[model samples]
Target: MAEQKERDRQEDDRSSPLIDQYTARNPEQFARNLARAMEELGKVAAAWTQAREKGEASDVSAAPIADMIKTFSRVSEYWLGDPTRALEAQTRLFAEFMGIWANAIRRMSEAGIPDHAEAPASDKRFQDPEWGRNAFFSFLKQAYLVTSRWALDLVEGADGLDLATRHKARFYMEQVSQALSPSNFLLTNPELFRETMASNGENLVRGMRMLAEDISAGRGDIKLRQSDASQFKVGENIAATPGKVIARNRLVEVLQYAPATENVLKRPLLIVPPWINKFYILDLNPKRSFIRWAVEQGHTVFVISWVNPDERHGTLDWSDYFEEGIRFALNAVEKATGEKQVNAVGYCVGGTLLAASLALMAAEGDERIATATFLTTQVDFTYAGDLKVFVDEEQIAALDKVMQGKGYLDANRMATAFNMLRAGDLIWPYVVNNYLRGKAPLPFDLLYWNSDSTRLAAANHSYYLRNCYLENNLSHGRAVLGGKKIDLGAITIPIFNLAAREDHIAPAKSVFLGSSFFSGPVEFVLAGSGHIAGVVNPPVSNKYQFWTGAKPAGELESWITNAQETGGSWWPYWQTWIEKQDGERVAARKPGGKKKPLGDAPGDYVRIRS
Candidate 1:
């Protein structure tokens, strides 16, 4: 209770601000932004001139220039060619709001009472007491949101635009609409106004300091989180599950988590996490830690903690990740456990790699995997959700140029792209709280983990995006990794496919498509949450639910119709499934017999931050 009070005080103190201060400084800030943008543009122009003068303006450079111009032209024509269209949309929106108001007033007069309408569950802007208890502001808030929605639809409905182009436009439109909402401003938000008055402008001073720090940190474009580096540390309090790094290679570190039970399964469980982020996501905390839970469930669990890549690691491709990363860990696990067969689990891109590895192993007639579990993994890229908008020939070419310069994709660049996918939730909220309301960021373990992202090697990133996102080769059995063509249908092992219903990266439907390629029995489960929460769900929380069905081979719609709802975590169900696949129970063994314990569970690789 005392800690809660302290947090509340921090929030109130942080949130005190003024519309006056913002309005007063708006002109100066705009001028500064404009000047910096012009300076950057001038630098680019100078570089282009220097390149041409030095005879370095080859066809490669010229092609990107030409393509960029073409894209600009097409986009300009789509939105700017019909200037009257946007104005007409605004007019129509005003007319609709007026009509709504008139109808509401007439109904109230006839009924001789107030007629209140419920707000949409997704819209929290009008949830404030000022908007809900006050009928006038309530109607105004609804009208504003309705107009915002209509404006977005108008932009998205532009004719002759590609799906990718449409999505990109809508994304920006939503950002602007969300930012300009009345709830974000101090003058409009009654609660914020009250706090500002009470604090007597100290929040504004603190907010300015916060803005300056962000500018210093080179993340002024968007304030993603409020917490500083001092807020949390890894391995001590956060990723502190008991384990040992039993094996290590250049590409991966194999973490053998200490068994939490007296008796363990015959087959060990190997986890393949995505190389895009640190592996501690699975071992986040004891309560929500999936690795700790798996160990407690009587499984000899091991996970691969991928190396945070730098320029030197740029040449490493998908094959290196397969052979040196997953395969190396697999070999070490087999040597240590004396178990030929294993239960493999993969999450996100790691899941994709696992599926590919299993297929390649299957092709070699090496059936070492007894059961394969995929969490939010996509073998088929068709309908890959919002991420598809950023993948295309032109986008890939531009990204290549950036990667070639740096030898790897910047961590911030990748983080920004993912944040853009859910701008309303991830991007704009921080913008309002940090910039407008002048509030310090709340300390969230998940957000801290999110901010602690890793870099991707240039060649590895390029190959994965081109082959998986653009060509759709993996699902079609045409993607060649480690000099072998991987066929998903080749793996006939019992599969447990888990997908987040609201996953933006790997849509549930796209994940379900993998089941169609498998010949063996599949138990498809759909968990109720987004990407991270669905996978990290622990039964002790009893929060998010999951749905399971036997008809994994059927269409996604049919499976949903036939699926049964379970009111707890999907971990126990997975435990039972893996138990059936395991050989016989044996006494729990300690880590590192065949291979010596390298260090602690997370290892040195995970500690290397970009």
Candidate 2:
């Protein structure tokens, strides 16, 4: 036993060289610091001793009391006199338990378990008392691990110590690194993060969001929607292209996309796309573009393409979109195909514009819209998500001052706002993955498209926020559109409204509110993904699941319940609804047109970025 003790002491002497190197730069200072830490740890030992003495006086098993006292004694000795490896082992065991608790938060969040924003934190946070054992233990373990890693690294290439001591230092260091890893942090706020505006809470939430980006969380196992097609032909194209372009703007380049089939519904179809973005959302990729589906289903499809604004078109506003957009497009479509009336489908902000156009058209006794499909669009904006908290009288005033100098809102600014919304998924995960993990981000097609953002006119954005969202003018029956006093009651068309269950941008409840203004029959659908994915869903993948049952009781609550609960894209279901609305025809028209030449039905605009 005496010889074994001698060997152990000899091994300790060899590792002393690395220990000296680490503390050499400030040996006296480090020793002083270590002494202070030991003094504090000794206090913990004293309390554990008191508890043990009390337990020993009783008939109960004092084993738990004895163990805790030993742990505190071990920690106190290491920081002061001994500085051995055994203390670190106990610290690590305690830390593993806390880490298991931290990761549990994310699992709970993904499962939609509501957080206790109002719940008080555990009494373990009372650090001045013995109750703080949990917090104190966690802090101690974390520090121990950090020291262990550096100590291990120090001994890795050293010449002196036996293999076991070197291994002890190395193992502790690795264990410390794992304990201090950034992944161990929780990625959430008190749920109040969503309600925060210009406060540091927003910053905290943004920081958490940045940490929880899609990449950091690991690639989602959910499949993406895909489709396969062998040929492309509008049934009417067999003989000649039957679609017509009523209007074409060299200045705006807003091509009107409309098709002519064998038996057109008594009324034609007109589309309104948001100017903040180009109109191609209705005509995205071939297999899933709403316009492509519309054409194949035998309906006349017309889409408006907005000219991407640069330094030149920056001055454009609400009037230009009305007179030159809807009015011009309407006349052109009417003259080209000679249709007396047409139905309209508007998406996002475009639907708001469509609301104005319909109100004005109705006021003028020029009611032509037979039915309208507002896909994830909103006319009422009492609660426009986090977008509301960011832009109000003050923020808009500042933005207006900046935009006035440039003549329009920079597209990059719009991108920045959206980036703030999903900062976790869209922005920061890559930062951790790159700087800390030493890896590049995975290339995701949706992220690529999201990164491809566009600018909107300053006048339009300012007007849109103040009049539409902040003031809630459209829904209040207190706005004007195209020289007509606006009244939503004037909109008398069959309404098909849609939104998504998980859409952070346009929550389904808000979208469902639009039904209140309309006296006509209304149908609302809530899809299963976020904003973009839910809208562009395709049946090729079961990634999307939809509900299509009874109509919602109140557009909001019913929206949550009424979804018939179908899996995959809602595209096929939408097509079926369209076909059912119109009578059937035996033959489809030929593929050509007069003075039109069937020049690319969707046109080249759909192929370009905003």
Candidate 3:
């Protein structure tokens, strides 16, 4: 026993030197880094203060946080108002804690004691081997998992809350649980602890410095770096598809991509991408560029590249978008290609606008658009996913008030909201990597495009929120644009509505439900991925599958059950469909056939950063 004890002591002493060596070798450098980190932190504080003073900081009165508190208060009232219910909740939690404690005791006493709690297999936060192998960390992980599940259960079991309130409570509970996960903390996370010790606290120093830099980049807010921004340039490597800006308007620049084939479809293709994000999402890189791929398929593609709006464009509304953006692009396409009949594609919010525009054009007897395609777009906001949580009346008013001040919503505000929707995936990982591990994220083109957000004009955004999300007017035919009520039924042109199965922004069910509103023969395709990936998926990648079976007449589940699943990208399938609509070939037309070329493929408008 004495010999075993001496051996264990020696092992401990040997391990100590590994950690001690970093401090001994670089004590002065560590001190200097720590001092620099402190200075950066001070700058972060000052920047925050200045932003608040200038009224540039996010409004604390926003409903997300406030509604979370209010909803939880109602939950508390439900539990606390009845002593028995509160006692039951307490007893349940207490029992779980007791079970964990007993297991922990057994673990200390014996060699192998089964965990009393286990995080879900899909939960990446507890993936570290030490979280399960080490008794101390295993206990902490299990305890945290147990407590968080209990908290969520309480919210789920709570009575007397409306559906909206319940949803808010659940979302907020998730946010809190994710934020408070043991892995987020320094000592609680085994990986962070090991890295800090190995580096003699230099990791934290570097992390603090990065935090300061990110805050500065966001202009007082932390613009979480998901990818190395330094690695991407808009026109050089990304959005590098050969094309020319044939037309430019105050709101949009119409880029006509050069044809890759000798002949092209007689009917031109116009893409209306959402202004909330840059058009480069579709043209991220040649490998993933949908625009480039479409051009290679022998189609004249004209994409509307919306200008990142500012105070100057605040007064622009949906009508302006319809007229100056879509209408102007249509007119430009005609002038460039001399084609009156054109096939149009709209993505996300852009699709929503295009649907409304079609309705208005129907009312005005304009039949220029021959066919329409919607990509992960939701006309009906009924099952709009978590985004609806931010669309209540109180929140809209608050957002409007903030937008009114600047004439446009800040890009970061929207980016943060989108990130929050998938906080477990998009947010906390970056928080751990960039700020905890003190490591720079690797360069990823998709992530770089995601980070490049765009501001929304005040009038346009406010109208969209009130009409689409708040009222669900577009689906119901109550949406008014250009002084005409929007009736999706009036859009009798053949429609191709694509919905991502895993879409959060525009849920598949929502899109399926929306397909029924169109009087045309709507072919709803369910792609097997999220919003961006499912749409941007090229045939060469063969990454995800897509489904197509029946018209979206029945429940989404029934359609999904009856649908035929096909492997590989849906791009070729869509191309076949487009050809079926109009297969007539014409000599490949040059960009800006009649009009003067404004600039290169990704024009000056896309170069504007928010």
Candidate 4:
């Protein structure tokens, strides 16, 4: 035992030298860097103040902080109102802490003891080797995990709260826990501490400067930079697919890509992407460009580039989107290709619009669209994911008033909400990297496209929230559009519905549930990964797998249990499905058949950053 103690002392001595190698060696330099960081922080504060004066920062009244507090109070009432229950909750937490303390003590007495509490393997925040190797960090990590789980369990076990209130409480709790993570702070995070010590606090100086610049860019708010924005441009490298704008309208520009094959399908493909984001997500680059691949697969593709709406478009509602957006594109495709019937594709909210438009077409005896494809789209919001937390009547009313004042919801507002959905992945990591660790994120095309947000018009956004999310009208055959009641059963067109297994924006279960609403035979395919990667997966990458099985009948889990997994990208599978619908071919047509070309593909509207 004495020899073992000597060996342990030697190990500690060896580690001390190694740690000293990264410690601040020059006090003068460290002082200078600290002073510079302070100056940068001052600038950050000033920029925020200036933004507030200019009304560029977030409006306090418009924020949901109050709503969060109100919901949390209800949770508090559940726990605190009952002495026994409060004691039980406290006792449970105390017991967990005691267990963790016992484990820590055991770890000290015996070197090989495992952690009492461990983060999931997939959690990147706790991936640093020091988090496990260092006793202090390990204990801190376990304590945090235990507390966070306990807080969440309290919300789950709480009574007297409606589903909406409970959901809000849970989401709010997650956000708070994520924000307060030890990994977010330099002192608690071993990696950040080491980085700061090694660089003599220079990292913090750089980080503060970047923070000030980002705040200024956000007009007094911190517009977190998720990627190196300098490395990407719209037409230059990112959305550089060869195509031309064959038609233009107030709401959309119909971009028809140049043919990449000798022969093309008879029916031109029209894609109605969500107006909440640019159409370039489908055409990020040639490597990941779904549009380019489809064009190469002997199909003429036309995509709608929605205008970044300002106050001028505030009054535009779903009808305008249907008529001027979808209907206009269908008319343009007919003029461009001389084909009245075309295959249609819609992504996310775009799919929702397409589903409604198809119903309207059925009612009007218009059969322009031959088939429909929905990508991570939700027609039924019954099982919609975390996004539902934001859609109660009270919140919607408040949002409506805010939109009325500004004519549209700001891009940052929408971006923030989306970021909050995965705050652990999206928000906190960026906060630590950009502000705490003082590092710029690597250039990523997907993140770049994600950062390029679009504004939501008041009337249109309000109608969508109230109808789709709040009321779930589209699925119930109660949705009234353009003074006509929409019936999903009336539209019997063949439908290809795709859902990502790990998609948060649109859950797989929700998509499966939605598939049942369509009267037509729906070919439901489940792809691996989240909303973006799952849909944009190309054949060459050979990354994730996709699953196919019996029609989307019964529960999602049951269907998945009976499903067959296909390796590689779902792109080829989708191509085969497309061909199954219509295999007739014709000579490949140029950008514009009859209509004149306005400009290059990825049109002018997409270039307009909000």
Candidate 5:
């Protein structure tokens, strides 16, 4: 109760400026708002006695709305007066009052109720239909309609309105972005979501993707880790979950939680971290930590911990990522495990780099690599999922402008971009709760983690877009890497491929396309989830599903023909294939030959930040 009081106080404090804003500078605008408030107060008074006079077509029929208006009287009283003194006060007060009503509408919308989708709240078609429609009172509708009209007037630069009203309108539309506001209509409707999905009718795909993500989140059983400091010390072991980086020369070090047994066991494996976020997505917690599971399973696991890039790293490109990212990590893993013939597992962008490494190695005839696995990784970007539509000329140009200002893509900018892709799910749900219900949005683990993002080097992004996505060079069995032409056909070693059934960034079929270009025997598995969750899937969390073919599920058509559907995570299936290929449990020892680390395991280049 005390904490709630404190929070309420803080919110009031934050809202105070908005209340006092127009009082001093804008008087004319205040009058319009003052009239609206008086008008609402009059309606409320009538609604209380008249509208509720039995048979007055009551909107306050709902227990919730009745309770809401009973409180609104008290809440609005602070703002509702003669509409005479300091008209600016009236304007500011009305704007703030409207904020409350807007929030209320939003809360009601989040029930996924269809009646809320349209205005005037009649002719209802929500899941609850009859039960939900009659909930709102005609009197409350009158109050809301009047205030909303005032808001529209304020927004349109209406004359005779006080400086505060006009300022509120002009200010919020461009700068305030009532996007998260309880009353925001943008998120509640299917318009925004429909626009994106309209391109491919990816409704089923999106549903599958979200289902997989939920499964992954369930595994994490993840607890929110909040802090004001970046570097945190816990039990003498430093774990860095730096949610974001604002300054230069900083990083979020996701802990590599391998079990004690993996400390010495053979078959060194370096887990490829995706470029989209911190590596902790894979090693979320003890229950969901793939690293912990792999180590417990007796494989010496080492993960590539990437430095959060900044403006200084803007010029870094694909060549730099290979030399310093995968190559550098491989060198360190070799030294740690004392084995040059280690396995490699690539994920998303990291998987692409692994594939690039294979070609780079195959070109040089370096076969220290024993086996390779690509989880939801794509080399061919022709059908690059939902993300492809975003790469259209106009959108990319807008992105270039946005990126130009920072030289490096800002992490939050990326977060916002992706959030727009699922605006209804990620943004609107909270808007409704916080605004209409005077409630707090759900602090979902996935949403919280989704907020954590990382920047990609401008040059690296350019290389990826042009060489891989645009040119399709990586899929043609020909692409240059490490000063030599990389040929996928040259890699005769065992290869494992898994693509997410619901992946939007890189469609499963598109990812499987690479297997067609490879000469080696290929095993492709289609996992049950989307991009991230599909790869991070663990065993304890069953109930998810996957698909695999007797041979390879390469190309959309053939894979569609031969695919065999399965009903559990592909993790166990992968373990069987991996076990068959991995021979001789050579005790884990540090490499002594050319694989020796130049200095320490983490290395200087990786540690290198802005």
Candidate 6:
């Protein structure tokens, strides 16, 4: 027993060096933060002393100080309240996990393997040889699954935590648990362990080098083995939908797709993709391109490709986006098609901006938009899912500091935040493949587009989160744009609202809630997939399904309860809706007429990297 203890101590001592290598930089950062806090406190103390000496009244605002204490108390309660109960829960879960492993070991000793579904169907990591068939590996997977659940439940089911506080707690806890999963480490992951033996540790060496490169590039937290940006080129393999740039501005480039059908709808369609990402998401490939699909549906399609902003465009605001971005594209589409009215579609943040523009336009007595369609958008952000965990004033202030320093929100930083929302699906699996197994990343079009992120100008991004996300002013009729309070209920056009059931960024309930604020007749559709997939689903794929009803209720859950399920994509339904709103078909307008083509589809603006 003494010798075992000695061996364990030796092993722990050896592990310390490896742990220190990863954690050495954290101490300095912590120290810097502590020093800054102390400095600020000192300044406050000095000011208070001066005020007291000058016969001025009390210290800095007691109300704000009291509020700060209350906030800290709430945070502390979340972390440290009911210590005994938390400890008991942890102990019970640990025992349960140990018992599971013991049973597995006993079954293994009898030369038998246990068949158990330890993970959800969505988690593909455990499908590896380590967890599927082998007895010992199956035990590890079960133990891991048990422990992960315990850790998550400990935070989620904790007492004295409000709904919002518990959600935030669980989100961070899940991230930590996922990052520390057995599948993400070389020794613990059986497949990687075998591979390491086969390659004589060469893979580990390669993985170490990869880790070094990532750390040097400051992307260590980006666990996914993202696609090589070099493999993709705009207007070539991806975003290859044949089209011509009809108009260009400092903020956007409007591309008009070549007609695929003989006769096209007289009313043109204008699509506004979120500037947070490049526009190619809607035009990824010919097989799945929404632009091509719309054109093939006998509709003249025009999309705005937003310029990837930089320090040069730091001062651009929402007003600029309305004036020079969507509104500008609207004018161009009208001029190019000679159609005074057009049907408009907005996806994600683009939807938010489009709704703002429509409200402002309606206020100004502009009736250019005939029909409005929103795809996975949240104009009313009251219940905007897990992303809102960081929407509090303190977090926003911290984000403000970051944006102020960089002039624009860094693409990597924003990507990291989004990835955190779905870490188990997107992050840990790649951590295992890229770092633990030392494998190269494959070429995936969706991931390539995900990695191909665009910067958000400081002013624009800050205003967006502050007003729409934080203030919820857009739906409340107090959202100001171009010095006017834009009211959502003012725009009474036919509306098609599509919300994804599994969207983490924009919750379906919030999207549904936003629909209630619109005075127009709304066709609220809920699709079965996530944000991107839900929007890009094509009828030809015959993949996921959607739910729709005659009239949606005020509550989302009730609407879903009464909604009817339909197989295949929502694109066909959207097409039918568009056709009904559109006028009689005419000879399809060519890509360009009097004016020359500015450039090819997925134009110069998309080529710019942040």
| Predicted model with the maximum lDDT | 4
Candidate 3 weakest lDDT stretch, 10 residues? 17-26
Q: Per-residue alpha-carbon lDDT of model 4 for 518-538, expressed as tens digits? A: 888999999999988899998
Off by over 4 Å in 1: 1-91, 100-122, 131-143, 155-166, 185-194, 218-223, 226-229
- Report the C-alpha lDDT of model 1 over 335-411, residue by residue, as the tens digit: 88888888999999999988888889888887778889999999889878777766778778988887887678767
lDDT for model 2 comes to 0.54
> For residue 282, what is the lDDT in candidate 4?
96
Model 4 ranges with Cα > 4 A deviation: 1-23, 60-63
Q: Write the per-residue lDDT of candidate 5 for residues 241-357, one digit (tens) a residue.
A: 211111111222222233345244457776777777656566555566666677666676666667777777777776777777776666655555456787888888888878888
Q: Please write out the lDDT profile of model 6 over residues 1-610, one tens digit for every residue.
A: 9869855654443344433322323455545544554454454445445545653322222333344445445655654667886577768787877778677666666655454436876677676644655556677777778777876776665567788777676666676678777788766666565555444455555555555444334332232447765677778989998899999988899999989899989888899989987988988888898888888888888999999888778888999999999889988987788888999999999999999999999889889999999999999988988777667676677677766765787676677678878888777766666655566677888898997888889889988989977888888888889999889998899999999999999888889888887888998999998998988998889999999996767677888888899999999988888777766888999776567888888789998865
lDDT of each: 0.76, 0.54, 0.88, 0.89, 0.54, 0.77
- List the candidates ranked by lDDT, beginning with the highest: 4, 3, 6, 1, 5, 2
Candidate 5 TM-score, true structure as reference: 0.59
Per-model TM against the reference = 0.83, 0.59, 0.95, 0.95, 0.59, 0.84
lDDT, candidate 2, 387-489, per-residue tens: 5644545557767776666566655456545654665454344443432222344554344444434557666677788878679887887776665568888
Residue-level error in angstroms, candidate 6, position 51: 43
Looking at candidate 1, what is the lDDT of residue 297? 86
Looking at model 4, report the run of 10 residues with the lowest lDDT sum.
6-15
Instruction: Report how far off residue 324 is in candidate 5 (Å).
Output: 0.8
